[model samples]
Target: MDYRRLEKIKRILQRRQPDLTLITDNVNNFRNLSAIIRSCEAVGTMEVHLVNNQQEKLYLINKVTAGAERWLTQTRHSSIVTGINHLKKRGFTIYATHLGDPEGICCAVRTLDYRKMDYTKPTAFVVGSEKKGISEEALENADYHISIPMMGMTQSLNVSVATAIILFEAQRQREEKGYYQQLRTSQEIYEKTIFEWAYP
Candidate 1:
């Protein structure tokens, strides 16, 4: 690779947040999925978990993703429960996006101001399908239910747009914490990723 391309790859790798991630709960729309992956990549997210029981194959629109999916590690789960369990085992604090009353179902999980939460921790955001919001299982398994305050008549934003908003907020918080300035990934993984990105 050229020196410029190598340097750019290294710079992006240094900013990658290995601890921050996202989970999609049956987001079937290819355009939305691709856009969500693009936003995740823009925010330096290293991995994304997908839970789609309907289709075995996950498709992405190349135009929407803009090749961003190539750099991210995408894992498919059989169910939302399985996905949540996997993340929980890996020490990821999941934040599910929901618009309903925080205390409607149960008081255990309360909706918090998205900006107030600490994104510096090992965090993962869960977004559901376009038609339906997050599943009950996801909300139950999530560490917190978060929502963006809406001012206008529209109840919620588009799935991809909301994902971008939340991810950018996380990017901002992580940047303030100096998380992007230093390499958070392990040396072995970093070297392997750099090799793959530079060569592929």
Candidate 2:
């Protein structure tokens, strides 16, 4: 809740033009989805596009996202391929979260595990549940793929926790590059989100 830092984030977002996104491939867990929403807010992402086959669980999503959902604009679609198409239409370089081959998540990720990333352009991150990770459609559509560097004996982080690490790392990187120092949305939307998040 650093106002100055938020202001700096605004400037950085404007200059770097980082459109960090979280895409779910048939993610059925509301808690995990909700946690991802919270992480997105912490990382200065204004929007989230969700792809699901059903909408009956909207109330569940709202509950899990809590009030954080108000600050983050979430859009939904009927399918993963449809969602990917939408993001691509908007110029995002879609990235699917898959197990990498000991290579950096992206074309130029760091070895530091939590290295700073550059989000100066449109970037979309895709995450799936452990049971089904990234779907075939999502993997096929992604421009790049990434996986967590698990030094421990365990194989993975919970979906939500993994999202937190990945997004915060991107956020941290964007901070260093000063990507959040610019305005990415209209003043009306910005003020509205701030007021809701600040007061709610």
Q: Could you say which candidate leads in TM-score? A: 1
Worst 10 residues of 2 by lDDT: 108-117
Off by over 4 Å in 2: 1-18, 60-66, 103-117, 186-200
- Across residues 44-123, which tens digit of lDDT does each residue of candidate 1 receive? 99999999988888889999999999999999999999998899998989999877544445344358778779999999
Listing every candidate in turn, what is its Cα RMSD in Å to the true structure after a full C-alpha superposition?
2.4, 5.7
What TM-score would every model get versus the actual structure? 0.94, 0.75
Report model 1's TM-score to 2 decimal places.
0.94
CA lDDT of 2 in candidate 1? 95
Model 1 misplaced stretches (Cα beyond 4 Å): 101-110
Clashing pairs in 1: none
Q: What clash count does candidate 1 reach?
A: 0
Give Cα distance to truth, residue 66, candidate 1, Å: 0.7
The Cα error of candidate 1 at residue 48, in Å, is 0.5
lDDT score of residue 117 within candidate 2: 37
